[model samples]
Target chain A: MKTIFFTGKGGVGKSTLSAAAAWQLAESGKRVLAISFDPAHNLGDIFGRTLGHKVTRFSANLDLRETDLDEAAAEYIRRNTSILTEVYSYTKAFNLDRYFKVLRHSPGVEEYAALTALEDLLRTSDDYDVVVIDTPPTGLTLRILALPRISITWVDRLRRIRRDILDKRHTVHSITGTFSEEGQKLAYEEKDDRVMQKLTELFDRYVAVARHLESDANRVAVVFNPDYLSLRESQRILDGLSDLNLGVNVAFNNKYTQGLSEIADSMERELFDGRDAPPPVHRIPWEPYRREKSYEISYDLTQLFAL
Target chain B: MSEHQPNFLIRLWRSLRAFLRGIDQAQRERVVALTAYEARELENMFVLMLLGSFAGMPSPPSFLAVELLPHLEHEIRVLNRRAESSTDALAEIMGTIDADA
Candidate 1:
């Protein structure tokens, strides 16, 4: 399945553009799922429907979902907390529940949850022909996109440390025995250790997501208005993606008007001139009369993006 | 018939064998202690990597680390024990000497 991600600074019309892309792809007879990763979701509003964490049907072949990052973080912590409590019952005395309550609000939890949500959808979305993602603001989106690479490195080092630990355990077992004085079994092999297995699985998942982000099937686009601030932020987004070795497939110059025509030209030049091979810029004209009707905007966007 | 006794050569061989067996047992015990200590140290390092955020080091996300918390009960206890003894330099030195001994 092809995946398209739309990202930029807040208020750059990423949601509207991504929704239009999904609508257009679905209208063309391809099954599509459009997901909004921003906390302030407007994909549902654009489609004139109330969307939530679950997939909601919008059209014959289009499905929409608006992720609640806070809820996603909670769900991730809740699921893992149950497993931890179940296996480490002795830790109850330490009041791990309280510790987990604190962890629910820890830094990076939301970004990790966003990555997990994306990974889950990608894995389970085999029925769809295309998946269009409307990402959060620049900072959050970049963190989510960069997570898989960072996580893969961490998991690799962890696996190596785990192997060293297991080898030491094997040596200890050979000298003594594989069981403690209380008859508790000791794991000296990778296959027998749950932590090692978990680390391996995590490593594979990170690698898969990293490959997905860097694969040819994925297309990333930056959306921005014809203004200085928006242009600067869009450049930052492009630079961040470049650092991750991912290229922008297209750029949408949204809300273009005659008054800013000259500014738009210079901004476009400034945005892509120095790049080795710049992506084609698609200018979306501002429609003052149709501003209230997102359907009309999307209808126009459908034709524009088709080119 | 009078009770027969073991010959002096057989007695000597048995005593020698017992002495060698005692030395082998002591050596095995020493090796076991040393290896176990090494294993514990490695485990501590592994736990640190997983929970490095606690020490202000870059660590894996908490959600990922939480999944492996079940298998880390032993390591957690070891960590706690070390933490309690860490403040006492004399005790740590004594522990090192005792383990070597």
Candidate 2:
């Protein structure tokens, strides 16, 4: 009942859909928040207001947060900075802090932080009755989306390594398994467990994120242009989400009018019917008004609500 | 100064010992096993070391971080630009609840 997500290739109006959804929910007298967790901060520019990392209310009931992924990633690192010093002689071989700074810019760092933001919002915040996520483009969004399973797989491998280390250490100390590695094994186990726990926790956490978005209790809508290719791509994404066990309750936004608007195509009429071979594609047709700003969607919200 | 270095095996063993000690109890077995995977998890191991090193300081554990962060920042600036393909219009997304609402 509390979550939704709008993601597609960038420039497909994900931010716009998120804003409209927040506006609609707020207008309905529900507490709502729209989040743009993309590394890009276009949501602020789209909403015509800059937002801090935390919730900053844009209207009476709608709050907007455009999490700066770098800052969020730093904060995530800060949370566990304590354990880093106690266990490893990190300062000896290299400047550990400097190393992390470099690692943060590595290929997938932004997605890592962006997923962390979603984790923070879902776990920490209770300020909204509905939450809408404006994700990055398709490729990056998939990286973020697939992170849970990816991290889980990493943990499984880490666990195997821990077991092997135990086995080898035990073999080395056959005479005194209890006396020899007992101390060192326990210490190493605790630290390795901590890492595994961190990663596994995220796996469960992403499930909650996906489940909340998929729930029929809340609403989820896919926003795409009225083109055959766009609809096909959206369906592919929908299939991917389904593979992850997430549901798309309703597909909306990208409203068009009669007689050749910029994006409207004849295939939209058939796609809206959702009666092709696959069957059971949730198709909500386009509404009349399409505006640049989220606030402008309130008038259209009433009409949408009726539909 | 001696041109000859310590025996490769001795040096490798010492580093292995140090790396093992840096890891946690439960992770030790994995670390040892993944010692073979040094080529693969080296970056990850290094990250683990850094986070462990900078455990509880106000600033980064090393001054080198300041230099590294700026270099990374410069790279990100360059990358973010090349990454931006088209000036896509930013749009708003929101919704009314299901009739269940």
Candidate 3:
């Protein structure tokens, strides 16, 4: 299955383009799932449906979802705390709840939570032919995308230290004869140490997600308007995605203006002024009906996305 | 009365066995102390490396940090003790290296 991520500056209409693409892909009989990773979700507003944390069927071939990061983060914390209590029952002296409260306000919690949510979605992505993601605005989306690699490296270091702890525990068990045969088995078996096992699971999952993202099955579409600010943001998004090895498959120049043709052309030129020209750019002209209550992607716009 | 007063040879052998048992116990105690000390040092190093971010050193990712925090109360307490005794900080670092090696 292929994954398509749409990312750009705020108000650049990435959601609109994402919705149109997913809708069209489904029309062509592909099993598609459209997800909104944006905290301020407008994908549901664009589709005129009340979407929540659950996947809502838009059609037989298309599914829609809007992630609730707060809920997902809370659930993640809860699960982690329970696992900690169960696996390391000897650490009951620690006020884990207090530390969890501190973590709730710590930096990078949101991105980690979002990654947790994304991992959940991608785990079930094999059921579809394509997954369209309407990512959060520029900065946060970039951080979220870079998280998997960062997390894997962090875990690798941690696993090394954990191994040392287990070795010490095994020595203590042998010297003191403190534990039963089963207890010794759990402590001495590197694979049975709960912390090491969890870290390995987390590391492997991140590696899988990262590999899936960098594979040919994934496509990233950089959406931007024909203005200097949007164009500048697009460059950063393109560079960020390339850094992660997720090459930009296409570029969408939405809301094109014919009367200000020179301004648009000059901005586009300056956007890629010092770099190689990007992938095929599709320009969609301004439509009057886009401002209405329920916006519809015209057949012409749908056809453009098909390319 | 005659049964109670075993032979002199039997009494000598019993005393010798008692002496040997005492020496064995003393040696065992020293071995136990050394292993316990090594185990404590290893546990401390593991905690310091994993939870260093809480002590203002950049450690692992926050999610991992939070997950491991419950098991880290002892480490945090040790860190507080080390931080309180700033003069011993250098000695503590040296000690960890010596123990690890």
Q: Which digits, one per residue and each the tens of the lDDT, describe model 1 over residues A189-214?
A: 99998889999998888888999999
For DockQ, candidate 1 versus 2, the one ahead is: 1
Which candidate number maximizes lDDT?
Answer: 1
Candidate DockQ scores, in order: 0.62, 0.02, 0.30
lDDT value for model 1 = 0.82
Cα deviation of A40, candidate 1, in Å: 1.5
lDDT of each: 0.82, 0.54, 0.75
Give me the overall lDDT of model 2: 0.54
Candidate 3 docking class: acceptable
> Worst 10-residue stretch by lDDT in candidate 2 chain A?
A179-188
Q: lDDT per residue, candidate 2, A93-175, as tens digits?
A: 77674454354444555666776677778877675677777876666666677666555554455446445543443443442
Candidate 2 regions off by >4 Å? A40-42, A74-97, A160-207, A210-219, A227-236, A253-255, A261-265, A269-294, A298-307, B1-101
> Judged by DockQ, which candidate is best?
1
TM-score winner, 1 or 2: 1
Q: Compose the digit string of candidate 3's lDDT tens values, residues B11-66.
A: 98899999998888666645655554455555566667676777788776777777
Candidate 1 Cα RMSD (Å): 3.1
